[model samples]
Target chain A: MSFSIDQILRGDIPRVERPPAADPSLVPVRLRVNGQDHDLQLEPRVSLLDALREFIGLTGTKKGCNQGACGACTVLVEGERVNSCLTFAIMHQGKDITTIEGLGTPDALHPLQAAFIEHDGYQCGYCTPGQICSAVAMLKEVEHGDASHVTSDLMATDVQLTDEEIRERMSGNVCRCGAYLGIVDSIRAVYEQQKGQ
Target chain B: MRAFTYTQATDASAALHAALQNPEAKYIGGGTNLVDLMREEVERPNEVIDINALPFSQIEVLPDGGVRLGALARNSHTANHPLVRQRYPVLAQAMLSAASPQLRNLATNAGNLLQRTRCYYFYDTTAPCNKRQPGSGCAAIHGVNRIHAILGTSEQCIATHPSDMAVALAALEAVVQVQGANGTRRIAMEEFHRLPGDHPEQDTTLGRDELITSIDLPALPSTANSLYFKVRERPSFAFALVSVAAVLELEGEQIKNVRLALGGVAHKPWRARTAEEALLGKPATAENFRQAAEAELQTAIAYEHNAFKIELAKRTIVRALLTLAERQLLA
Candidate 1:
């Protein structure tokens, strides 16, 4: 019952491509997911989110709005953040991708995850995965001298992970359950801990 | 979404060749807008030519003290480029104030400029929208058009181009460079966009076969201070109800050069040419800005539900100019 972007667009079941039309049909795509390489055979239209959940069995990335409006499908592609639902599996053939699955495990939680646990960042927990992934990506983006809307000094040499900075950068992710306070607090805690470390 | 053939084009010529090969082929960049249209069943392409792998992702300085931004350069990358931040701060600020980080990361420079309108009727299949289905009859003409245009509109369409980045680019005199089947051509930023006069379906001046290669921006002088002021319902991830991109250069106490652009008020990113002409060499006072804005918007016509736009647009322009001039006075 999954939707292919083409089926919805065409309003019918799209004809399967001719064997020669797609070279190396459904070939295993090699991707560096979560700092590790993965080889998965997928249909040409499979999105990165589906490829991870169906092929690799990482269901941490939730699907709230299949469109990019809700950030439930956020992921890091080559150190930059992107909406995973809009990306094709084949397009990311040899690129590095980091999903919520790669962030941390139960046995060893990442600093952000620990902060969320400490500060209670989630109420319904549906948007937590996307929020955490977006948080992780924003941290790296800020460190790299990328400026946010609230970043007044565009040429600032050093970047501080301020609360306002994190909020502005992480505005893509939503907490529908109304856990914004705790979520921002969790991210701030992580930012403080990372600075201390 | 339906199943379609996907081809990755590694260069501009290859992209054009592939596009020419199929009438149903559509170029794909970040897929932020295209995928949304697909999910809504508004756009259907038999084959999608992926342009993400193309060599169109660089933002660099051009030879003549100008800036050259590639088509595939992500919004995040373009908004934060050092040269853009320094020379065209309004463009940088406008881009930063656009959709949030994740969406911006996946939206390209060209795609942002070429984005379709967010009109409700166009998105809703049941409603009659000329932009979505030309000659279907526009329901928004007398229907709910609070977000529709007030200038450069027609009986057929009143949809507005919804790009904060383009609004600022228009004021900066940015030029769009495209490669087509015939050859490469440069379109001035002001002419790149088209108003929804008789043809509501036509979006830009670009031909169907054209692929925008890069955007060229003229050198902005240091004293020509600029700012992008956006008035939205929310502080984040919301389209502007009214936005102003103003770049003004002052000589002592009088205006030397002025460029004013308005968003969310016109069918395209409207360059306030009339207002600019009126304000040049005049004292950079609040009253002069108000007069200039009024003269520019005198021809503006509003729909039933959006008449506030005329006044709102005027206020936005005056406020943005005054703020820029005030900063100088304080300094």
Candidate 2:
């Protein structure tokens, strides 16, 4: 007799124990994170944020809400910014994930990193890692002619990175410290510098 | 979250088979909403079928000039698609206004259609939410329900469908393509999501084993002048308190065709057919728009803390229609 999902969820039937064949729980996930290849043995429920922090010991990516609502756990997956907490570790096997640690070093900081420091783009600095990572991807998105909510012209291939566009693009990375003005200034400085190049 | 088995489905058939064979299996694409629910133990799937590797991720123009968005197509990609931006600007605006840049990158088209309600009581397991647990009773009936539904609500539940994309799709009359163990089928956009009647547990008309393959957007010239206007607490990355997706086709100063839908006011992306029926063949004036909004919201039943939504939705509808009308005149 077939059982409904509700019945199985309520534990009405015996839990299925895998035979000597395949154990689907312990998945083997290989990811290139921060220019480092990591072979991880994780469950399907293990989020990418947990894998980075607990398994790989990259604690720089802060876990703010552990949900997509707050972008505190933002990271770059295949050069596209995403919420690490919402994605499974096994789902990102072949993709390149760049975290805060992979961004830059103390000796030579990324332009955005330097700008953030110069403009004091943070206060408590708890959400700084996610903010920087998101901004890096945001800048790339704008450079690639991606449009935001404030984009008036959809036909224009070259999206002008106005202050409103930057704010709209960077809206995902929340700075609870009320450092929005500084963050905007920091992003603008780096954007202008990059344009000069 | 509870420990669960996982298998990556490389194709749509495999995904459907896995979900059909396994009683507590769920197909995950993006996992923005499901992951959050899993964390709260609201969803306890014994097995997860990863459908990200499936071939359903392309935005193709149909032979009939319609746009077919693959189920796995990410929201950001779909929103920025040239065809979508030009032909369905309302959809692009809705997608861009939803969630955040990060979420839009990960969230898929079909996943957005199946997103659950954002009711605080539903997420909190300790609270009695009929949507989460049938017959558990609805705590949001008297609890802090400022964000709860104001229309299509029942005595059992008062939860709102929180998807700006779905609201626009509702207005566009998009079709959902699905495949199940029984075979493939297409569901109308308005019929895909169900009202919160007696069975509050059932969100969509999709069967447990059915896999959403793609969403088909039929070519409609009038939809080009449509708009999706959202009023939320925050400017970005916030769920709507009241939003309207309105499309209008004008014959000089008269409304020839119209489609109106409301978000943050119902169990589903409510297609405001009453409003559309009221405005059709009428003058495209502010007074006419106001009257149509009132007609749609006539039967609205709001809770204690959510009575403001009734008025908010009405004003949003009028504002959205006016904005579309003004743009049409400018064009």
Candidate 3:
């Protein structure tokens, strides 16, 4: 029973049955995160961000804005970075999900993690996990010759990772403490080290 | 977010069947925009059909030198595809100029076209929005409308479609292939998006039961000379304040053919037909570009906080054309 706009404007609120209550049934969802598989029961409404923090107890991936505006919940799904807050956990059944916790540990830090420490890439550190996760994939994107908005030549096969390129590529993650300069330095340091190796 | 049952469809037929069975079902691709909208209560579907497993993730070049972009092709994949970057650089530039890298990674070609506006009043359920709740007053028409539409606006709605990719497609004259309950149909890029007339709620002419299969781009030899220029509050990761996607072909110093489309200016991608017509055979000069831009924006009606956009649009249009003309000359 659909009512037209004219009918609604005329104060004729269409008589329709109220939508059914939220489905409380917990659906079984299997997720592989940080090289581990976990089977759990979760509602379809649970986002990957919530599933990681609440159910799996992996709080490294922060949730700044759950509406996809902030990249605080960034995670690598199948090696491609995406905002975990914007996708449902139930949808990621067979994909390999990598969060900040999966990158490296404190003793054996990832090169980018060590570089971030060496360059002082954080102040408040609230957005660090997402920043590191984003950088992990962003470096891979550069290696694969992905173009950004600042990429002058689209046909060029080689991409020069300039400071401008890094800034443009990493624009998704925002640090409220304004650690952009240090973040740039850390990413560049890692990039140069990798090139040297 | 409202609880909804989720089901994965391995095939298009199963997806359509699921959608047909539930009148309140919505197909999900990447779930970038739809998930956020659902969380905000702007969109509430009782059933969510995951079409990610469907075989629509290919980006192939046709024999006619054109391109066919699968509906489920991720924005990043499409932008980085060799054919798209080499043949249609403007499209790749447009896609890159849009949302941040993370969003482009998750967003699909078809979902990008169907994304709703970033209208404040529409997202804020406390306020009145005709598009959100039909017959309700449009707060954007009188309230802070710095990001609202300046042309093709109705008294009931002033929201602009927020899609950088669609603007480029409009200029390229892309075709959207759709499959519905009846059969298959093709919709031109210009006619796919609808203007806010009496019914502000309807965003597109697509039937509720219809699903987008792919988008086909016609071969344009002059596409290599095209450019997509976007101006926003920031250099990156922001919607366009005024954007121009232009393809300029020149015979010596005279303009042979041109296509201009503007984003963040109207309900749909505003194809500057009047501007293109004015520059068909004219000398590619700054004065002529400005005149054509003026002719195209003559009917634009700017509101309180957006009167500056009218002039901004004119300047952007001229700058884009001039840049393209200069590039052509250098080539």
Give the better candidate number (1 or 3) by TM-score. Answer: 3
Per-prediction TM-score: 0.93, 0.94, 0.95
Q: Candidate 1 vs candidate 2: which has greater TM-score?
A: 2
Estimate, for each residue in A12-103, the C-alpha lDDT of model 2 and write its tens digit: 53323223225445778888898889999887778999999999999999888777866889999999999999989989998999998999
- lDDT for model 1 comes to 0.86
In candidate 3, how many Å is residue B262 off?
Answer: 0.3
lDDT of 3 by residue, B114-192 (tens): 9999887787666789999999899888887888899999999999999999999999999999999888999999999
lDDT of each: 0.86, 0.88, 0.91
Mind listing the fnat for each candidate? 0.61, 0.70, 0.75
Candidate 1: DockQ? 0.38
Ranking of all predicted structures according to TM-score, beginning with the best and ending with the worst: 3, 2, 1
Tens digits of per-residue lDDT, candidate 2, B13-93, equal: 888778878888888999999998887788988888899998889999999889999999999999999888888988999
Q: Give candidate 2's TM-score.
A: 0.94
* Residue runs of model 1 more than 4 Å from their true location after superposition: A1-30, A35-41
Q: What is residue B176's positional error in candidate 2, in angstroms?
A: 0.3
What lDDT does candidate 2 reach at residue B57? Answer: 91
> Clashing residue pairs in candidate 1, if any?
A4-B1, A5-B1, A5-B2, A6-B1, A6-B2, A7-B1, A7-B2, A8-B1, A8-B2
**Each candidate's DockQ score against the native complex?**
0.38, 0.38, 0.42
